[model samples]
Target: MQKNALKNIIYSIVLLLLVFLVYLYRKDQPITSDNPDSDVFKMVVSGQTMGTSYRIVYLDPSGRDFKQQIDSLLEVFNQSLSTYIPDSEISRFNKGDSLVYESKFFFPILAKSKEVYTNTDGAFDPTVGPLVNVWGFGPGGASLEDSVSIPDLLRQVGLEKVEFDSVQVRKNTPGIYLDFSAIAKGYGVDVVGRFLESKEIEHFLVEIGGELMAKGSNENGELWRVGISKPDEEGAANELFGIIALNAKGLATSGNYRNFYIVDGKKYSHTISPFTGYPVVHGLLGATVVADDCMTADAYATAMMVMGTEKSIALQKEVEGLEIFLIFSDENGMIKSYVSEGLKPYLSYAEQNKPSLDQ
Candidate 1:
């Protein structure tokens, strides 16, 4: 398959997104706070490992009612989207017909994913489960390296090779499966965002894993600022490669940081290419995308990773309203970066102050 064709396939399978809440620490000296809807202070119920934290800060005259509502919202979101629960819609679908059939819940996201797949020319595949498992990244423990042969693996993988009817989805070849891990978190974020909005949360921030969506503003009226990870080093973040005013927008980042392996003397990325049946070896270390929906941003970031730096730039030009930030290594081994033009609208003051490598 051509590079573009391969990317489109992986793009479809790479839709799963994961979120963790991490930790929340309030100011040592209670920062001046304001009251809006209800005076409900921020509280984190779980750890980041729980994946994605949904917080609601409201002006609640009666703290009891607000707390109850927040808890109810969180429960609803978990019930609907949690893969950890075997009874959840996603979990059931993933374990049942999703193996060789399509369920009702799968169609909604599948339909939405079609546009992203077509636009990226198959760079983003949501049906890359089989490959993910063979590479030892699936739900099961890592597969023996020798058990998977790359050439043989390629024959069984391909987005086009998978057939999906309205009622069922099946692979052309046996043993191929689907995994939406890449886009799941994004979907989860959207779910939580909607739930909060239903509670009349006009302004708030929601983050799952690294996927996030921010809107409205703190009572003080400052836009929510987010920091993007610097892929050069683990646990490093740049002040602000971009910022969304929470004028109501979302951000999702896909990178080769958390999951990867070293083979021989080279490092292999976890974002595997369905076309080659091999982990992406490109110098493009990470890509962050901003869009109205966190799911789209999440999947698109992975697609861009396979597109690499050059193709990603060209593709960005063709797609409007899509912003991308790529961290890549040049020939000399130095890490370099690029940002799509659309991203300029969200550039934070600090990002603007930083030297523009593109120029």
Candidate 2:
């Protein structure tokens, strides 16, 4: 009787352990992992815990170990990049205190910001935080209808007021704020790609927010296909004027079609021009840039928007490596598009009313 009782107890314990293992397996069973022979594994990490959905599709079969490493990589990125969390490095810097000295990731981004500032003649300034806040785009908040004095907004729009030595970052002006809206998403994508590469992920695509970075080819030996969003409301994938085969490169787009509010029937772009301290009502509707780095693509898109179509296309021609597509709205409300010669092979113009060179 004693022996039978002991056997029963052991069997119950084993049963519970089995159930727990099954639950975990069910929870984490890879979405498209069965493609061991197949090239791509598409996994969607919910954006609820993190700020946004981090969609990663890796080509190689490093398997469970690769997934574990990806989880750790995400943890580090969230700690360093999340602007909402006060403890994040960016938030800590924003909190105002003893200089939260530069980390390996933060300083490089800040340093590179100066290049975009110089290129756009302060049009893409990261220091436009004061304006963004006045508009209520920051965590402290802003209002689209609030009576915003143009001069008041202009006072806080330059990079000259930001003081960053190797050890500290200080605001030279009181109302001055630093919001990295133009480039942070691209930087985040870069961080994820670098982390995956370190873990022997030779092939993958990491997208944060709307920015994307692709590395290597899938198991089928094809570069990743990424669809550029259309500014037109009626367009579908077939109407997609731009598609790129990405291999270890990043792509980004900036547009006025989304994330904007109309006040007094005047349409405003969320992509503000720092020099004017106002949302651009430029004829250009959207600009997409493809480059070796997400940060560069992100920054360049903002620069191009401020430059407008004419100047942007001219600049693209001069820059030997930049590949860009510019879409514009004419005085008549018709859509017009242009692409750099280098991007010609990958691009397809969806609209019949293409912008003319005479304009």
Candidate 3:
């Protein structure tokens, strides 16, 4: 995969248009001002991590600088879970390490992966690593298009085949590998979010690639506004899916539109189905999921894309703390949209009253 391919695959779901929000903050435009004190100044930070870029904006009421701390924390996080890092814990495990000790950063995502795996009926799986590799999405570019039978790799791929205690993780099948790429970015956002809160920073926006979490309000004291870019367009300005308020909530979007390939006139998406061991071929173009935390939102967004619009909306009714909006092409390949009741209020605001961005 190309360096930008992974970023595109993850971000195809949502784009946190911080550029618009940053404009509002920099101009000191009368946006939303929930804060009474004008002593706060905004610190905008950007850096590279996990093969993608990250941007953080926060109200720096105190004079403390957290750039170094943020860097160090992400470094540790990469060492623990990054698949590109050869000696990283995840890479080591994939290379058949039996007793690799877990990191504080690793356990939570691993545990959460299991939770999402079960909840989505295995739609969101970490153990699909082998399947991912066989689909040519992994490090080595390999594809198993010749055989109609499910490849041997799928036999080794299942969350049930992996076991973990507080101490360590063990794979029942040696080939069983854990891939947190789908979830770790959101976890990273939460890690930074926690650090910001620890330092008494109340309002901030943290986004890695496109996965994001926002707390409190922008400088205008109103809720943080974010736009979800339309999935079907390429380079014609941002025809947004919708603009919505994000306050103290994590939002994640996942889609197959930008991260798919064509073979024999059939488009194969990066979203591999855990059950069929093939890239998802569906009408569900994209899904943007909102949850109390970014990790949960991230997993569900990917799952919803796999589940398609109907199943995702059905799942939303049963799952609490989730707000979803799905975009799909109908029978005639015409654009149609769905917004769960949970998400309607956030996108209901008018253009002028929107917390960020003029259009």
Instruction: Work out candidate 3's RMSD over C-alphas.
Output: 4.6
Quote model 3's TM-score: 0.87
- TM accuracy, model 1: 0.76
Better of 2 and 3 by lDDT: 3
Most accurate candidate by TM-score: 3
Candidate 1 local lDDT, 1-359, one digit each (tens) = 13323333343233212222222244212223464444444433322322334443322222223445555655655554455556765555555544432333455556656667788887787666667766655555346366667777667655676556566554466655455667766766676677667766665666766777777665455666566544543342433433334447777878775455544555556688866777887777778788888888878887888778888888878876677777678888876778776676666434543565542
In order of appearance, the predictions have TM-scores of 0.76, 0.79, 0.87
For model 3, what is the C-alpha lDDT against the true structure? 0.75
In terms of lDDT, the poorest run of 10 residues in model 1 is: 15-24
Off by over 4 Å in 3: 1-37, 142-149, 233-237, 348-359
Worst 10 residues of 2 by lDDT: 16-25
Kindly list the per-residue Cα lDDT of model 2 for residues 269-324, writing each as its tens digit: 55666777777767897788888888888888878888898888887776556788
Q: Model 3: per-residue lDDT, tens digit, 1-359?
A: 34344554444333333112322333221222345654677677777888777878877765456888998999999999987788899889888846457578877887888888888999998888777766656655445456635667788788899888777888888778888878888899999999999999998888887788899877667788777655663532255556768869998878777665555565667788888888887788878888999999999998887788778988999888998877788788966677777677787533433333211
| Top-down lDDT ranking | 3, 2, 1
Candidate number that wins on TM-score, 2 or 3:
3
Question: Model 2 Cα displacement at 190 (Å)?
Answer: 0.9
